[model samples]
Target: MSSKVPIFTLSNGVRMPSVGLGTWQMTGDEGKTVIRNAILAGYRHIDTATLYQNEDQIGDALAELFAEGVVKRDDLFITTKAFCHEVAPDVIEEALRNSLKRLRLDYVDLYLAHIPAATRECGSHRTDVKVEDIWKGLEKLYSLGLTKSIGVSNFNESQIERIVKIQKVPIHVSQLELHLYLPQKAHREICKKHSIIITAYATLGSPGRMSVIGADGKPLFESTKNIPNELNDKNVKALAQKYNKTPVQILLRATVDMGIVVIPKTTNPERMKENINLFDFSISKAEVNLLEAHERSKPERLFWWPNVSEHPEDPFAAER
Candidate 1:
């Protein structure tokens, strides 16, 4: 199709695969198998964060793949993010090195600050650290070749602009909670102006969000049960029927059509295949716009960081 998925080029000319595997709760031997299967199923990009606590397993999966000659480290685009505790300028590089140790990689293709909020301890928010300092630390990592590209996750428009204004190294990507309901038009525009690519984390089926255990052995976020599932939306259903694809497929393809990268997570091998098989059909520009506009009207948000929501530096502080 004319709208087939294409690799997104970062401002620095790094080619990132449009579709990636999101490893949130994927862990243990099972998680390793799922990661391995996803790679075999055609996903070249893998996203993980130190907060996820699954880097070791992912590293094991990749190591096995490399030893088998099924895939080389150079063939895949691996991304990992440092948690808030490591956001401090002095701690960022050391934290990433530990993550690199766990991931069994010499360097990551992309590295991100998990959140804008800085903390001495992972959960205890600190008001003293500057966002610009974090950017400098990320820039240093890029210079040292610990990460090929640097970026941020869950940063607000203002926080992003402040960094952009002072950035010695451009923010190559921004990871955000983007879905049909929260299409993030404003954030997209800002990133577009700075040539920063965005990686949208899937919120397609967020029912168990509140119960997701964080590294501290507690629920990660508040409940998302109130928001209607996009897969159940009538418009999404209609689109699926018209395209002879599933509702999940329609949502994924429409997002890619909007020029944003998507990382959909799944432990089920069958669903993993379904998520990556989005290139065969093209959702027309008119349809994509309508789809985004339709679901956005209701504007439901599926995830909320209750832990850091009240922190002074939190971008989503108003949402509380």
Candidate 2:
């Protein structure tokens, strides 16, 4: 842990770094190198999931670092999630053990339910498996000390509330696709009231990934044209100039100022260095207000799963 980066204390009293490296699309030897470089670059926290398929690479990097005495096991905070299909009560522990095997670690600092919806092996949504049942499995893992803490990702307020009401352990964090363009204020408020820390992914507005062309090479989201790129936004650029910082720094700082943790992924060494160098500067209250005002009145979600939206517990479809 770099002294420059601050750490947030979870409700369970675990310390988590406020800024982390997200290993979403990173894989293979290249991904291993990226994880190694990020650790050397002062990133004490790293986020990955079973769906990412790069846990082994991350494991390799951490093993090297630990073997070389570059960092101790306790010095790092690693988080991984169980895939939606593995959320069933019977499969939860097995799924976690498999992830631990891939990560080459005895335990993970935090484990999350990857999504609110459940799925079967045939790639079909399972409406019968409820969130409460999956939560019981998470509680089992926590009690066994397989994970120091447990949480959820991509869960809405109502779904989170349902779990919280029946859960024996408190929800430690809620990971979401949040950035300047899509602040998700409503969801943030709900989490805040319940003492659930917000972990933001796609913190950069996912610059070239907002819209993807389909198999026929056409746009995926209809509102893709209406979404503004935060990196190129006039307001962001002006703020960068005013603060003598890059747009990325300004955007990341905005989230940090609001007490939100950000995990911005990048394999570029230079960008990795730049992402963690956000603590030296502080965005003023007025400037933060102006930056927050840049949020769209209507949400422009970059990630949408229309196929799973029909699920009864679909977090996105549920009202806030």
Best by lDDT: 2
TM-score of 1: 0.94
Error of 2 at 189 (Å): 1.3
Candidate 1 per-residue C-alpha lDDT over 1-320 given as tens digits, one digit per residue, 9 for 90 to 100: 01234799999988898888898877788889998898888888999998888999999999999999988888889999988899889899999999999999999999999898888774788878878888999999999999999999999999999998898899999999988888888999999999999999865765546567767886655445466778898888999999999999999888888888999988899998999899888888998878866745456666666667778888788766
**Clashing residue pairs, backbone N/CA/C < 3 A, model 2:** none
- What C-alpha lDDT, on a 0 to 100 scale, does residue 252 get in candidate 1? 88
TM-score of 2: 0.94
The deviation in Å at residue 76 for candidate 1 is 0.5
lDDT of 2 by residue, 1-320 (tens): 77999899999999999999998878789999999999999999999999889999999899999999999999999999998788878889999999999999999999999888888877699988888988898999999999999999998777888988998998999999898878888889889888999999888977545345655677655555667778998888998998898999999988888999999989999999999999888888888888788756676777775656788778778432
